[model samples]
Target chain A: MRATLALMQSRLDDSPHLLRLGRLFSETVLIEVDGAEYYLTFRDGHLAAIAEGPSRKTPWRFALRTDADALAQFWQPRPRPGFHDLFGLVKIGRGRIDGDILTLVKNLRFFKEFMALPRTAPQPEETA
Target chain B: MTFEPVTGRYLTVTVQGRRQRIYVEMAGTGTPVLCLHTAGADTRQWRHILNDAELTATHRFFAFDMPWHGKSLPPEGFQTEEYLLTTDAYIETVLAVSHALGLDRPILAGCSMGGRIALQLAALHADRFAGFIAIEASDFQPAWYDIDWFHRPDAHGGEMGAALVSANISPHAPDAERWNTLWMFMQSGPGVFRGDLSFYTRDDSLIGRLARIDTTRTPVHLLVGAYDLTCTPEDARRTAAAIPGATCTVMDELGHFPMSEHPAGFRPFFADALARMKVADHV
Candidate 1:
């Protein structure tokens, strides 16, 4: 799971669309996966930091919560319903989002595309 | 109502002066509904519609694969080359298939690329169809996303294409339906998706042509999924407004590939549109 977040950070850094879409917004977001928390710091349209565990000093603009299983399925090559998207997970009771609804709505496309990056990345080799 | 097995066969037809073998599937009996599959997809997209006992009993559903798509291989001479479907070729194929099958003013229904062609048919040859049903279609697709990602060499026949498609699948759809929709994308032939997009995003333009359609002769109906980013409900409404008397309906909990993504959820909307078309036909 940590590796997936690291891969996501790399993908987000390299994505021109995400950078362009998120250029106007600068905020820290909290993504909680089954009690585990990760903080994403976006600055000047790029992902500046991805730190695991909650941040006590920095105030998060938004917080999204979901089970680890749902997060895993969302990153699958082809995810099923209830896991295909963040909003979809919420719709099916697998996930939820709180705080800064406006920020989320204003940059919905960027966030949606950003989270979907793992699916487009090359899969890791399977070990025997 | 009980579901019945659909019968499938290959029909020889001359499209664009080239002899091609088109694979067609048919079920039920009554008013002929000629269904067109979305780009890179085949007749299987209409499985739910074909198997619906009520729809079948009232109307005969026919879905055909375009040349070089699904079971319909390209003509013998062009087997080795990459097949790129153009607007002209697509229109001609649909016309040729309809003529070959001797369908009398069949109701033409299509989704995505198929949906776009429905408008082209109405604009160019309105008399050939009883009614036109366009799902997730629009006059223009804004360059919002990078289409090149789907065509990247590394992504070819890999998870990238399927992943992109899965994103468009409605998150509200059932798990089985979402997986089934992704299966279609995974099974599509190489370069077929990109080739289809050439027509979808590049060559096909119906902006000026929409006004030329005679709705009195052939009623046009537009249905869009609420969740479709490519062809949003607003786009469908704009298209509907352009064509005189064209009715537009926005389907909720549906996305780009509505029929395959959530056929059961989409059935009500499909039935409503078909019913309205039938009523308009009599009026």
Candidate 2:
């Protein structure tokens, strides 16, 4: 799971936008179980994380882990009273609150944005 | 068991000197839910959804035509957001009708543009609602600075206004649904396009006011569709996160108009929202 988390991190860390944004939090906790893996990354604006749950297939069942309180703080519309200092406490491969469904939302209020500005159409392949 | 038949009504009211007739269909017994239509759509977008058995069993529902569309009269200066009907203006219009019909402070259930007004009303007159259900309410634009990809002048300029109607269903929806969505946009006339620029470009901080929203005791539940293109789930999450105690629920596989797109899935979420607000003093 740590390896998966690291792999995901490398990808996001490589993005220019995220890099430009700087690290919101110093460290993140990664959890994987039941074919699901979630990375709870803490950052400045709020307690932010990325979850790649059971949506992925095979060998990886759905499992999630975060700073215990981090899971409780996630679904809150606004930041909980105190979630900043707890960033470093989150660890990899520790699946606390595994069966808790509300824990997903209880930990973070995940907002998904679907709209994208139309992208340019791919040009025709150069014919040899 | 005593069953009462649902009743519907229509009346013409004058707003800013324009004779806009409001058509209303309401039934049930409890606090009312004032339904607002989205951009480029009329009241009928809510027509079928309102008739659902579960909704009727819970509370009274009132849906009306926005000015210049459906049965309402076309106002003179609606193109500009400044000139278009405002939260206060609509409240006044509804007040007159409600006063005539005897209604007040019903929970607001709005989508898209209607959602904006609901948020506005909740912020301004917090005492009015027991709770609010805003479906895909526009909380402000997302990554507005990242528009390097958009290039269609018409899409930007409202030339393809037909494509911009509110509470959107889907491109491949049945013909009748498509026509309804298209007609809603068309009914806005050229003004709808002009009005969108005003809507989409409004200051973001105005929306930030929700951060300070004291909804009296009324809690707000954000019912956002996971796949909503217009409002987007990220916007919903961000907006919900901004509010103090707002509960955010994202319906799966649903689009901008969850009520129309997936009522069966939306009912339980709606019920849960109402239940959350039903707690003491949270009204």
Candidate 3:
């Protein structure tokens, strides 16, 4: 999990086109897997830091929460039907997106692309 | 560069008691093939097929924009009622156009909603066309999300619609075609995409429709993209099962909008389908 997140942080910061897409976005997005949460803070499109969750102090605009099983399938080399997409998760009832939906919708493409970074990048050896 | 092979024209036809000057495009000369686009999209979805040099050499292709989409405008009294596509109306328009053109059993190549209707066409009017080619389609597609957001005031309708469709595209699709597909989807008229989905997601009894489809009369070939969650490969296979002798091909590394998102990759699959259709005719 740690290695994968690090890979995501590096890819999100280095990819020029992705950076351009998220250039206007500056917000903290919570990614909750199983019960553990991680705060991904972005400053002007750059993934500044990812905090291991202590939800009490961290403020986030929106959170994409899902189970470890779903995430595990999603990060596979080729995910199955219901686990392949972010919205696919929602439809299949394996995931829940809470908080400000407007912010999420406004940056819909960026968020979707960011979440799919693992699929695009070299898969980390660590299992989530 | 000015004179491309493809040509465009208007066909004034009456269907469902309303006259519409439908925009239609054509390219090449040979056995005629009438193509149909996906929901919320115009004929431009078939641009690649229309312009395919190899296909053009062997087959003539025609594509049209549905009324209220692209260059085709709605009827005079359109403002009085909502634009909702029904099965009967859909069949009427296709038949009207085929009759207007004086085509002799032209093959029907349709995708998505157009594809769904192809099955209906095969059942109701099999003799009119040589065969049916359905792409990324199924007997019925379950509504996966709340379609209300597609046309609501707060959301940018076009972007919202495109966003939903975009995720279904294969990750390996080329950047150019992928963005172009999304761009066209982003130009959808307000409520138009939603209206199209109403018909696409209509829960009318398809078991009877499928049972009536005689593959012997109108040969059926279905192609579904692997990444298509809207109408998964499983759906296509199930549909083929319902219609005996129908063929379903699962296109790997492609998604819902196979033609628009990965035209180059889709060509071989389409060609294979065409070949199969030819063999069926000989049989």
Best by DockQ: 3
In model 2, where do residues sit more than 4 Å from their true spots?
Answer: A1-128, B1-7, B12-19, B76-100, B142-159, B164-179, B203-205, B280-283
- Per-residue lDDT of model 2, residues B181-204, tens digit only: 556555554454344334544535
Ranking by lDDT: 3, 1, 2
For model 1, name the residue pairs that clash: none
Clashing pairs in 3: none
Candidate-wise lDDT, in order? 0.80, 0.53, 0.83
- Per-residue lDDT of B104 in model 3: 86
Off by over 4 Å in 3: A1-28, A41-51, A54-62, A67-84, A89-103, A117-128, B77-81, B279-283
Top candidate by TM-score: 3
Give the candidate number with the greatest lDDT: 3
lDDT of 1 by residue, B87-189 (tens): 8988999999999889998999999999999999999998889999999999877543344544545334423456555556776676677777777766877
Winner on lDDT (1 vs 2)? 1
Q: Model 3 in CAPRI terms: which quality?
A: incorrect
lDDT of 2 by residue, A1-114 (tens): 444445544554444544433333233434544435564554532325555554433222113444434533332332222221121112122224333332221222121100
Off by over 4 Å in 1: A1-128, B1-4, B146-148
Candidate 3 per-residue C-alpha lDDT over A1-128 given as tens digits, one digit per residue, 9 for 90 to 100: 66778898898877898899889889999998888989989988888988897669888999989988898888776577667788778867999988887777778888888887887443422211
